[model samples]
Target: MTPLTGGVASDIASLKVGDARYCVKFALPKLKVAADWRAPRHRNAAEYAWLEVAARVVPESAVRLYGRSDSAHGFVMEFVTGAETYLWKTALLEGQPAKGEARAVGDMVGRIHAASAKPNFDRSFFWNRDDFRALRIEPYLSFTAEQHRHLAPQLHDLADMLYDSTQVLVHGDVSPKNILIRHGRPIILDAECATMGDASFDPSFCLNHLILKAVHLPAQRTALYDEVAQFWRAYAPHVSWEDASDLEARICRLLPALMLARVDGKSPVEYLGTPRREQVRKLALPLIGNPPATLSDFVQTLTSRLKELDAWQR
Candidate 1:
C-alpha cells in the first residue's frame, strides 16, 4: 500500500488489487491535524453518493467508484495515474501555466451545476449541512474570525449567508489539489464536501486557489489572473440565475473572505511565508470591508491594491 499526501480530511492509500489499482478513502470523525475539528463519519457516505450522481451528470469529469466498506467508513475508486495524467496543483507548482485548461475546468463545473439544477433532479441526500459547517465554516471561516477578533462580526455574517442559501449544488472544496488533469480536461476528486448549496461557492473556492498561487509565486501573477478571467468567462454563461448581477456580487464578496481564510484559517497554505501571510491580511481586510461591484472589478482592485502595497516585492 502507498500512502497519498496533500490531504488532511481522510485516510487515503493506494492498493493494487490483482492487476488493477484502486484508491481507498476513509473519512475520519476528526481531521488528522492538531485541532478540535470533527464531523460525522457518514460524510464518507455522502461523498460516495455524490460520486454516483456526478458520474451520471458528467462521466468524463467523474472518478469511477469501485466499491465501499461500511465497517471502515470508506470507499474505493479508480486510481488516476500514468504519464499523461498528473495533479493539476503539482503542475501549477512546477511553473506550468494553465490558461485554456482553467476555462475547461470551469466549463465542466458549470455544466455539472447546470444539469443538476434541473427541476426534477433529486438532491435529497446532499441536504445535510453539518459536514459543511464542521469542515468549511468552523475551520476555514469561523476559525479565521477567531484569529482576527475585529473581523469576527463580518466573518460571522458571511458564514451565515453561506449556510442560508440552498439554491444550487456546491462542491465546497474546489482547490487545485483535488483536480487531476488528464488529456485536456480536469477530472475532479474528493467529493466529501459536496452538498446542495450556493453554486457561487464552487467557482469562488476554485478562484481562491488561483489567487493564492499568484501570491505564492509573484512572477506568475499575470498568468494566474488571466486564468481566473478565462474561467469566469467560460462558466458565467451557464449560470441560470434570475439576478446574475446579484450572484456575481456575492461571488466577489466571498472571494476576499476566502482568500483571507487560506492564510489565517485552520489550514493555511504550506508555501506561504510570514511576509506573504501579512500581505494577504492587508489585502483582504479592506476588500472584506468594502466588496467590489463585479468579478472584474474585484480582480482589478486586487491587482491595484497588491501593487500599492508592493506585495510582489515583499
Candidate 2:
C-alpha cells in the first residue's frame, strides 16, 4: 500500500489486490496536526454515505464505492489510474488550461442537489454541526476573524447563515484538489464534509479556489476567470428552488468571505504571497461589506479588480 498525501482529514492509501488497484480511506478522530480540533471519526461513514448518494444521482462524476473494511473503520473504492486522470489543482499549478471541465463540475453539483432536495434523505446520521464547526468554521472563518478583529462581525454573520441554512445536500470541500478529470469528464473525490446544508456552499467553495489560482498563476487569470463564469452559467439553470435569486445573492456574499478566509484562515493557500493575498483581500473585503446584487455582478467586479492588478502581466 502506498500512502497518498493530498488530503488532511483522513488516512488514505493506494493498494493493489490481485490485478485491481483500490483507494482505501480511514477517517481520523482528530486532524493529524491539530489534535485539539476534534474532528469526528464517523466522517468516514458520512463520506461513504455521500458516495452512495452521489453514485445514484450523478454516477458519471461519482466514484464507485466497493465496501467498508471487514475489521477496520474504513472503506474501499476504485483507484482511478492512467495519465488521463489528473487532479484539477495540479493541472492549474502546472499551467494546464481547462477545457469546459469547470462546467462539468457545476453541472454535477446541480444534478446532485436537484435530485436530493427532499425532506427525507436521512441526514440525521450526518447532521454534524460541531464536526463542521471544528474542521471548517472555526479554523477557516472564526480563526481568520480572530486574526482580523475588525472582520469578526462579517465572518460570524456568514458563518451563522451557513449553519442556519439547510436547503439541500452539499459537498462541502469542492476545491480543485477533490476533482479528478479523465477524458474530459470530472470525477469528484473526497466527501468528508458532505452533509445537508446551504447549496450555495458547494459552488462558492469552488469559485474561491479559482480566484486563488488566478492570483497564484497570474498569467492564467483570464482563462481561470472564464472557467468561473462557465461554472455559474451551467449551474444556475438546474437550481429548481423558488428563491434562486436569494440563494445566488447569498452565494455572492459567501464567496468573497471564503476568499478572504483562504488567505487569513488556518489553512491559507500555500502558494499565495503577501502581494497575492492582499490582492484577494482587496476584492474580498468590499464584497463582504456590501455584496453585489447578483452572481454576475460579483464576477464583473472581480474581473475588474483582477485587471486593475494587471494580473495578466508576466
Candidate 3:
C-alpha cells in the first residue's frame, strides 16, 4: 500500500496501517505555541478529559480523541482528518471550494461556542502571576532588555483584568489554521490550551489571531473579520453588543501584549515570514503600554488605528 498523504496541517505524522490509515497529532512544550505552562503541565489528563466532553457536546464539530502518549510538552493523539480547514478556506478564498463551505465555517464556530457556553467540565484559568510567570515572565526573560520592558508592563495589566473576568469555554484558540473543513464543515482541533475563563477569551482570540494576520491587509482583514464576526454575531445572538463591547474592550487592551505572547508565550508558533506576522509585530510596538484610563477609550483608539492601517495595506 502507498503511504497516506495528509490533507491538513503538517504538525502531525500519519501512516497507512494495512487497510487503515492512522492520523497522529504531536504536541510538545518545546514546540512553544503560546499560553500553556511547564509545571503540572496542561492537565494533559484533563485536556483528554475535556476532549471526551467536547466530543460528546459538539460531536459534529469536535475531533475524535483516540489515544495519547506524553511528549516534551504534552501528548499526541489521533489526527483529526477530512480536509485541512485552513487550507480549505484559503483555497476557497482563492476560489477553490464552494462559497457555501466558507459561510458554514462561520456558523460552525458559533454553534461550537454555544455548546462551549455550558462546558461539561471546569477549564477556566485565572490570568494571575502564575499564568504570567509561565507564559510572559518566563518566555520574555529570554528577549533583549528593550523588548522585555516593552512587553512586561502591558502583560501585567492585561493579566490583571483577565484574572477578573467571567469564565467560558471559547475553544481557547480558533484561528483558521486550527480549523479543519472535514466533510464540508468546520471541525476545530487543538484544544491543548483550551481554558475556561473570560467569556470573551476564545472569540477575542479568534478575532485577533488569524484575523489580525490579515491586519496588514486591511481589505483581507475586513473581509475575513466580516465573515468571522458575522459567524459569531449570528451564532451567539444572546451575546449582546454590550457583551461584545466589554470583550472587545479587553481584547483591545490585551492586543499588544498578545502579540508579544506569540513570540514569548509558552506554545509560540515559529516566526515564519508572513507579511501579516512581520507587520503586525512591528506596528504593535507603541500599543502595548501601561494601564490606559478606560477600556472604551483604549478600544476605540486601537480599532480606529487598526482599521486605518489595514485599509492602507490595501
Candidate 4:
C-alpha cells in the first residue's frame, strides 16, 4: 500500500488486492494540521453516503465506490492513476488551467445540487453539520475570525449564515486538489464535509482556489480568470431552487472571507510565499466588508486589484 498526500482529515492510500488496485481511505479523529483540530470518525460514513448520492446524480463525475468498513472507519474505492487521470491542481499549478475541465466540474456540482434539492430526495443520512462545522466552518471561518479581530463580526455572521442555511447537499471541499480530470471530465473526491447546507459554499470554495492560483502564478492570471468564468457560467443555470441573484450575493460575501481563511486559517495553502499571503489579505479585507452585488463585479474588482499590484511591483 502506498500513502496518498494532499489531504488533511483522512489517511488515504493506494492498495492492491490480487490483480485489482483500489483506493482505501480512513478518517482521522485528529486532523493532520499545525493546529489542534479534531473531528468525529463517523464522517467517513457520511462521505460514503455522499458518494452514493453523487454517483446516482452524476455517475461519470463520481469515483466508483467499492465497499466500506464502518468498524474500521475506512472505505475502498476506485484507484485512478496518473496514466488514466491527472490531478487538476497539478495541472493548474503547472500553468494548464483547462477551462473545459472547470466547466465539467461546475456542471457536475450543479446537477448534484439540483437533483438533491427535490422535496422527495432523501437526506436523513447526511445530517452531519457538526462534522461540517468541525472541519470547515470552525477552522476556516471562525478560526480566521479569531485572528482578524476587526473582521470578527462579519466573519462570524458568514459562518452562522452558512451553518443555518440548508438548501441542498454540498460537496464541502470542491477545490482543484479534490478533483481528478480524465478526458475533460472531473471526478470529485473528498466529501467529508458533505452536508445539507448553503449551496453557495461549493462554488465559492472552488472559485477561491482559482483566485488563489492566480495570485500564486501571476503569469496565468488571465487563463485562470477565464476558467473561473467558465465554471460560473456552467453552474449558474442550475440555481432553480433559489434566486440566482441571492445565491450570487451570498457567494460574493463568502468568497473573500474564504480567501482570508486560506491565508490565516489552520491549513494555509502551502505554495504561497509570505508576500503573496499579504497580497491575499489586502485583496480580501475590503471585499469582506463590502462585497460586490454580483460575481462579475467581484471578478472585475479582483482583476483590477491584481493589475494595480503588478504595477506597484514594477
Candidate 5:
C-alpha cells in the first residue's frame, strides 16, 4: 500500500483488493464520526448501504465497499482512485464556478436522503444511538476553567433548551474534503454519520464548513458565504422561505454549537484549531439565548453576521 494522505482522524492508502486495487481509507475511531455528537457509521456497512442506494438513485457517485476487517482501532475502505474533491471545491470557492457539479451534488444528496428504503440497506444501522453523545455539549462541557467562566452560564441555558430540542439522521461531517468531484460532479464518501430526523443537520454541517473555511482566508469570506447558500439552495429547494422557516431557526442556533463542538471537541482542525476554536465557542455562546426565526432568516443573518466577523478580524 502506498501512502496517499494522512491526518489526525484517518489515513488514506492505495492497495489491491484482488486484481483491481482500490483506494483504502483506514479511518480511526475518533475520525469515524462518533455516535453521540457526530454519530458513528460502520464504514463497511455504510459503503455497502450507499452502494446499494446509489445503484438505484444516484448511481454515478457511489463506491463499492469490498469489506472491512478491524485492526487495532481503525478500519479501511476500498475505492477507485480519483482527484481531490476538496481541491475542486476549494477552486470553486476561489471563483471557479463548477455550477453544474454543485447542482449534481445537490441532486445526489437529495436523492440519497429521499431514496426509498430497500431490503439490503437497513436505515436502522445509522439511525440507532448506541453511542449517542450530544456533540454540542463538548466545547461547553469540556471547557478549561478559564474558558469556563466565559461559557458556563450561557452553555447551561443553551444545553437546557437544546437538550431534547430536535434530532435527525444527519451527515454530521459533510464537507468539501469528504466529497469527490471526479470531473464535473460530486460523489459523496464517508457515510458513518447518517442519522434520521431533522433534515437541517446535513445542510447545517455543509454550511458550517464553508463558514469555517472562510474564517482563515478573510478576504474571500463573502464568496464562501455565496458558495454555502448555493449548496443549501440545491439541497432544499422544495422547502420555501415559508415552509422551512422553523427548521432554519433551529439550525442557526444549533450551528454555532456544532462548529464549537467540532473545533474544541476531539477532532479539532489543526488549521484553525487552537485560536479559532475558542473564537467559535465564544461566538456560538450567544445563540443559546436568541435563536433565529426561519431558515432564510437564519441563513441571511448567519452569513451576514459571519461577514461582519471576518471584517472585524481584518
Candidate 6:
C-alpha cells in the first residue's frame, strides 16, 4: 500500500489486489493538523453515501465506490490513476489552469445539487449536521471568529446561516485538492463533510482555492480569474431551488470568510508565504466586513485590490 499525502482528515492509501488497484480511506478522529482538531469517525460512512449519491446524479464525475467497511471506518474505491488523470491542485499550482475542466467541475457540482434538491429525492441519510459542523463550521468559521474577535459577529452570523441552511446536499469540501481531472472531466473525492446544507458552500469553497492560487501564483492570476468566471457561469444556472441572486449573495458573503479561513482558520493553506498571508488578510477582512451582493461584484473588488497590491509592491 502506498499512502497518499495531501489529505488531512483521513488516512488514504493506494492498494492493489491481484491486478485491480483500489484506493482505501480511513477516517481519523483527530485531523493531521497542528491544531487540536477532531471529528467523529462516522463521517467515513457519510462520505461513502455521498459518493453513491453523486454517482447516481453524475456517474462520470464521481469516483467509483468498491465497498465500505463499517468496523474499519473506511471504504475502498476505484484507484484512478493514469496518464489521463492528474490532480487539479497540482496542475493549478504548476500554472496549468484549464478553463474547460473548471466549467466541467461547475457543471458536475450543479447537477448534483439540482438532482438532490428535487422534491422526490431521498436525502434523509445525510440529514445529520454534526459532521458538517465539526469539520467545517467550527474550524473554518467559528474558530476564525475566535481568533479575530473584531470580526466575530459577522463570522458567527455566517456560521449560523450555513449551519441552519438545509436547501441542498453540499459536498462541503470542494477545494481543488479533492478534484482530479481525467480526460478533461473532473472526478470529485473527499465528501467527509457532506450534508444537507447551504449550496453556496461548495462553490465558495472551490472559488476560494482558485482565488488563493491566484494570490500565490500572481503570474497565473489572469488565467485563474478566467477559470473562476467559467466555473461560476456554469454553476449559476443550476440554482433553481432558490433565487439565483439570493444564492449568489450568500456566496459573495461567504467567500471572503472562507478566504480568511484558509490563512487564519484551523487548516491554513500550506503554500502561502508570510507576505502572501498578510495579503490574504488585507483582501479578506474588508470584504468580510462589507461583503458584495453579487459574485461579479466580489470578483471585481478582489481584482481591484490585487492590482493595487501589485502596484504597491513595485
Better of 1 and 2 by TM-score: 1
Worst 10-residue lDDT window for candidate 6 reads: 94-103
Q: Give a tens-digit lDDT track for model 5, residues 105-213.
A: 6566656655532244446655433322333234333442124466556555444554333243345446666776766567677554344435555666666776666
Per-candidate count of clashing residue pairs (backbone under 3 Å): 0, 0, 11, 0, 13, 0
lDDT of each: 0.83, 0.82, 0.50, 0.91, 0.54, 0.91
TM-score of each: 0.96, 0.93, 0.65, 0.98, 0.72, 0.98
lDDT of 1 by residue, 93-164 (tens): 777867477898888888878877889888887886777888887888899899888888888988888787
Candidate 3's C-alpha runs over 4 A off are: 1-11, 26-29, 32-42, 69-79, 82-151, 163-166, 216-221, 238-242, 263-278, 281-314
lDDT of 2 by residue, 5-67 (tens): 977778999999998899999987767653255576777777788888888887777687789
lDDT of 1 at 161: 81
Q: Which runs of model 6 end up more than 4 angstroms from their true locations? A: 97-99
lDDT tens digits by residue: candidate 3, 277-297: 555565556666542434335
- For 5-45, candidate 4 gives per-residue lDDT tens digits of 88889999999889989999999999999999999999999
What lDDT would candidate 3 get against the real structure? 0.50
User: Which runs of model 5 end up more than 4 angstroms from their true locations?
Assistant: 7-11, 17-19, 26-44, 68-78, 82-102, 116-121, 132-169, 238-243, 273-282, 299-314
Name the better of 1 and 3 by TM-score.
1
